[model samples]
Target: MRFGGFKRLRRFSTSRRLWVALVLLALLAAVLLLQQRSEPPDEDSGNGYAGLGEDAMEYAQAEPSHSLQFPGDHGPHPDYRIEWWYLTANLEDENGEPLGIQWTLFRQALASPDDEDDDSDSPWSTDQLWMAHAALSTPQDHWFDERFARGRPGPDQQGQAGVTTEPFSAWLDDWQLMSRDRDSGDLDSLSVTARGIDDDNTFGYRLDLTAEGPLVLHGVDGFSQKTADGQGSFYYSQPFYRVEGQVEIDGEMRNVSGRAWLDREWSSQIMGPAQQGWDWFSLHLADGYKLMAFRLRGGGEDGGDYLSGSWISPDGNVTNLDDDAIELIPTEHSEIEDREIPTQWRLRLPGQDLDVTVKARHPDRWLDTVFPYWEGDVTVEGSHSGIGFLEMTGY
Candidate 1:
């Protein structure tokens, strides 16, 4: 079945503009708000997390030879089935209390552009669905919220949810991550703000991010291979963001400063049906080094786990590592919300003489959104020292 309340919204576009906007919001609320606390799909249910493993043969594929460009690539790729602009930060308040923040805007095509109806000229004609998630995590609690909207890009319309690249702005309602410099390119400087409510406590942040190094590309220039069958995505990141800002939790605001990371990736098909979920990490080491790595369970050569990563130097140089070069082992687990999640991990990169234990600062950093997952701040120790973020999906 289609969205519950959207079929009736198309007829109201010719009415007053204010009424049209309200109807659009009401439609989104009907579709998503009810699913806020739903359970995640079963392990053997859909393809993968949020059906990301579903086949998309009709849409544009992320080819290895397809080179990625700046400024233009910063905007939405409507021809693709899925894309996201994700940012995560590790911050410390004035009192040295550590906290974490995550802001993400995701875009999914309801139908391929080739399949769009030629007669669909109304501003309400939508072929794209947008969702945003914002969260803040403290030592004892995690606050998170989700928002949804519907839009389609065309000459005559700027939908309620969309992104533009000239100055780099992404938003769904009041929550936004925008470029500070109006003439900025390559997303070197940015400011992000969002407010979310958890139970009765409200939380959010406003931060300015400045790049200290260059943007790093993963896999072959930007085509990150995801499976043994050659499925992958166009992936790159600005992991050098130096952040200065303030965060508010439960009406209490505190000055904070630390590092942040922004990840940009788009793909038609990122995983095969055999792949369940993934465990990913992005770490900023103490002695001026960074590492990005992930393990895709059941997507490897013989139905094992697929592993790949990038070992980045201080100056933003990247050394891509294949499965044989990197190792990840879960040494501890945390039982929370009726699930056992691995909260501590032992990561070893033999090629770089690097071995580190990555442990979550707290085990309560579970995001209870439409698509649930575990994400939180992590500490790096053993042959290295620093902090970063960890994300785990599919249990």
Candidate 2:
């Protein structure tokens, strides 16, 4: 569930949800542009609005000045056409074996908000389509699954899937990420549960998460610009959760405890066609500092590249970084699932005197999801050593 450059945790919902939304929007663009309202715009020749292209005027766009309100904003923003809630964690078993977990819920508005109000005549009427993906990873193996459904916004709405911030819950089928403390406005404490089966095995997790720090806003108070062209998303993260619970794989339960990261982002146009894909990183350093960074390929002048990141101090101060402030270079690649992927990376933050090599825990952490991508636990070595997660997409 990585949106190419978004590199999940905060990116899974963005990437996975946007994948479906863009595919659907692309189909719409194909039909509308081929019809050529006024002889097809040069930017949109019906190739689908991969990044909304020149036909983005039809849907609501994510502008920088938009305020992200409290719990309400934690739920669905159906007006935007696409949104997601993504959760990722780095857990350790009783024996101290590293584990990785992910759960994501994506909402793709089948029709614009204005249309949903008039188009749905019944609770079953489909205005918003939802998709979810869940996965669990051991040091040597990975398992995952995906599900889909249709929904409409209303108090009467009920299904295997939905999101409500009142009590703060996001779910699809039996997989859920919800709040444990209802009276609180912030997501201070929460519980996550999910069970999935992929052809040969059954996997799931039941975990308790408690926030140890405040929410970290990414890119100028949640407006994370993706490309140099300024297309981006409303992104924020609670990357300081302490987790404890049980993870079940193949029906075997293992008690686990570790740290987790929760990312919330929503946007209409998160990328442009020129921006091919991305390599994203979320590192939880041993000293309490956190880093979220990415490399968006091909959005520069003449289709070059763009880079950016956020540095969070132990006390929760965020230092927004531009392309020049940080460097993320792929140091090695591996052939996995028949795709060439960067299995290792060299991250350098000179100002902080931080230089490290982050490598995947294993190469086979390939999620055979609707939009398949690589997601796994990573080990950081060099200036500051720790563990984190890596999400690479579009390759």
Candidate 3:
């Protein structure tokens, strides 16, 4: 969900990590062996071999030119290479103390783009893998956790990841985003819960989310183009969730409520070969509008990374923006996880006559996990006042 660290890997021995990694590799090898064994003797050449490589490239290059569909589109798109359901909340306890929570599920495809013959016989044959991250940050301390699982296509599997409309449940394993309604399926009242343990620290939460505003899609018609060549992902958000729930830390339950934002994005090829990482922002303004922005950091000769975002009005009107239409300037940097991260930022949108300053709620909110980075709550002001989350990866 949130790609941030390699810290956890240190706890395991080289032999143990290798053993686990080998198990996964062996599973993949077995699947490949089975596919080769099942191929018909003379039916191979006509099965689009010459076109396979080209088809894969074409699939990667095809313009994400279509508009996004809701309800139906919110479900999984196994055809894509990567996808994520990211949620962040800025909350206050019953005592009005500030707190933050994050839960995210990331999906990555292991097979090539053209490998689409449904290998449904074996549950382990799926080329998709799922990973999730959960975190809670208070003024005094920060706690985070992560999970990984192989994606299975059936209900028999415990670590399943999918979305449904009628009951409005979207989840991966015990970590979920589901409707609180006992009858109808709507985005009104929802529940989110995640649990995990690391070393001697154990953390998790069960919270209720009530939507105070409508869902908003980013970019034109939901096709969020990321690169100059028009490579992009479909993105959307629910930025006005009033949260009232409880978090369990070290077996202690604390009642809390705050604002939350939910982000859903899917793509076939997210990072190009030359892109190292990305920095993303999702802000909920005090006056009602929401802001979402991101910049992909291209490595080597790929030039500066691509940047884009959306300006959503209070009533749900979206103003899609391009790189030239907006600006994000890093003013200060701090060493986080052995990397320099800009904790202070200046944002300007000329067309909207807006300029704002952004800062992290705290510097220690850095999640030191499998894929680590800075993903914490932040405050924004100047032209607008807001509270939201700021994420920096591959720093």
Name the top lDDT candidate. Answer: 1
Give candidate 2's TM-score: 0.87
Off by over 4 Å in 3: 1-7, 10-64, 116-120, 153-161, 182-186, 299-302
- Which candidate model has the greater TM-score, 1 or 3? 1
TM-score head-to-head 1 vs 2, winner: 1
The CA lDDT at 306 in model 3 is 80
Query: What lDDT does candidate 1 reach at residue 392?
Result: 88
lDDT per residue as tens, model 3, 66-159: 6666666666666665678788999888788788899988776655445556476975566667777788888887888765666665433234
lDDT of 1 by residue, 1-395 (tens): 00111212212223334544644564465335323434554567456665577676467999899998988888889889889999999998988999899999988776666764434667566667787889888888788876777766463225667889888899988889999999875688999999876676789899999999999999999999999999999999999999999999888889999999999989877777777788999999998899999998878998799999999999999999999999999999999778899999999998898999999999888776556788899999998999999988877
With a 3 Å backbone cut-off (N, CA, C), the pairs that clash in candidate 1 are none
How good is model 3 by TM-score?
Answer: 0.83
Instruction: List residue ranges in candidate 2 displaced over 4 A.
Output: 1-55, 116-118, 122-124, 153-158
C-alpha local distance difference test of each model: 0.82, 0.78, 0.72
Q: Name the Cα RMSD for model 1.
A: 6.5
